[model samples]
Every structure is written in C-alpha cells, then in structure tokens.
Target: MDPSQFSSQPPEAYKSSGKSGMPAAPPPAYQHNPAGYPPSFLNQPVPQGPYTQGPYPGQPAVTVQPAVFVTAAPLANPVPDYLAYSIFTMLCCCLPLGIAALIYSIFTRDANNSGQRELAEKNSKTARTLNHVALGIGLVVIVVIIISQIVIRTAR
Candidate 1:
C-alpha cells in the first residue's frame, strides 16, 4: 500500500490543467489584414537590407530593363614581367636587358588596360619567338665552330 501508487483516475487518463481554481487562457483570435491578404501571411518573409528595396543614398533609382545590359565583355591581356626578363636575360646576358624587358612589359600593361589585348598578345608572342630564334642561331654557330676545329686537328 505505497502512497505514490494512489490516484483517483489511475493517472494514465488524467490531464494536468495549468489553472489553479481559475479559467485557462483560450487560443489567440485570428485577425484579418486590411490588405485582404490571408491570415497565414502575417509572418511571411519580407525583403531585408538595402539591396532589395533601396538604392544609393540621396538618389531615387529607376529600374531599367535587365535585357539592356547585353554587351560583350572586353578582352584582357597582360605581359608578365618574369617572362620578358627570362627571355632577355638568356639572350643578352646583361642586366640592361632587364630594362628593355621592363619597358616592354610596361607598354603591354598599358595596352592591356586600354582594351587592346590582341595587340599585346601578338607582341608578347613575337618577343618569345624572336628569343627562341636567337638561341637556335647561337647554338648552330657554336656547333659549326666545334666541327671545324675537330677537322683541322684530324688533318694535322
């Protein structure tokens, strides 16, 4: 006969009311919006921050047609400094060649900023090609000299 097991309604079918000798609060009444929208939309999301609903300060913005912005993107090209220096350094073996490389890079950088990427790319490629040709010529001359020396020694 434990006191904890004693109950009038077997405890399973009983519900605890919050009120102690007083009436409990009823559910909130649904209020109709004056805009004639549904009551469920009372907590619907609204646009936040200046990006969606506001523009720059002090200026009233007019929304233009998005289709009007269908312009092609301007091409871009830049002569990297390291590439130029490496080419000149290999050929000239002089520090002053670095100055020439810097000048070319600067001119190309300007051209690139001005939207003349094709011209910049053409010049950059030409410079590299010229350097390769110069290198090939140098190698050929060295080989020819070595072969002539070997022939002369064999005849002696």
Candidate 2:
C-alpha cells in the first residue's frame, strides 16, 4: 500500500494546527513543583513553634470533638445438637428411625456448611424428632416386654 493514501491534504495544512484541525491551547497557569510539594505550599507561612491550645494571631479558635466509632455485633452461627441424639438413639433405640435421624443430622451439617441456615435448622429439627420417635418406640417395647414378664410370672 502507498503511504500517500493516508494523507488527504498537503503537508502545509498540518503545520498551523494539531491533529484536531485547531491550534493547541496554552498550558494551565500552575507550575509543576520538582520538590514533590504543591507550588502553593512554597509560599505558605510556617508554624512559629509547637502547637498550643490557642489559635494563631489572626485565626479564630475552633473546637473539634473526638470521633467515636462503634462496631456492629459479630454474626453467630446456630448450633444443633442433632448428631448426638441420633448417635444415642442408633445405639440404644430403634435402628430404622435412628438411621433416619442420623441421615437428617448429616443433612443438617451439610446445610450449615453450605450456608443455608434455614435448611440446616429444618434438618436439625427433623433429626431431633426422629431421635425422639426412636426413643419412644424403644421405651414402648421395653414396657411391653416388662408387662408380659409380669403377667407370665403372676399366672404361674
């Protein structure tokens, strides 16, 4: 490709103006300071001595209150005692209900780990209820066995 195709006008048209077709404006009035501080800071009056309670000679004395920041309470996670009950029921009570309780207890942990607090709470309640059911069934069975033994002995 020919480089001359990029230019629509002669080189004399580019001499007076920039790429925008207008002459560039002068820079701002502020001078760049090489010492890192602003140019205005160079002319400012320095402090006479150590800062006291009173104001400067021409300035008004202004009182400022110290800031007080209060942080919010931390989030507390819920603790569900489902696993312990499930384990106890599994050992000493009905096997099927105890297994269901154990499963729900595991689900509670999983929901808690996944940050589903509501689901975790629901699972925890279910596990506890199953544990109670297993315990009730175990107790009823024990009572029936005891009553049957009493009846057999009385009949003899």
Instruction: Output the worst ten-in-a-row residue range by lDDT, candidate 1.
Output: 33-42
Candidate 2 lDDT by residue in tens digits, 45-105: 4444343245545789899999998653322585484898898899898999999999999
lDDT values, one for every candidate: 0.55, 0.77
Q: Show the colliding residue pairs in model 2.
A: none
Candidate 1 Cα misplacement greater than 4 A, ranges: 1-115
TM-score of each: 0.34, 0.50
Residues 1-156 of candidate 1: C-alpha lDDT, one tens digit per residue: 898799653464334355456654555776644443333444554444434554444679888776655443334445542455545655554344444554555555655666677766765665554445555655676789899999999999
How many residue pairs of model 2 clash at the backbone? Answer: 0
**Which ranges of candidate 2 are over 4 A from the true structure?**
1-75
Candidate 1's TM-score: 0.34
RMSD per model, one decimal: 12.0, 12.2
Pairs in clash, predicted candidate 1: none
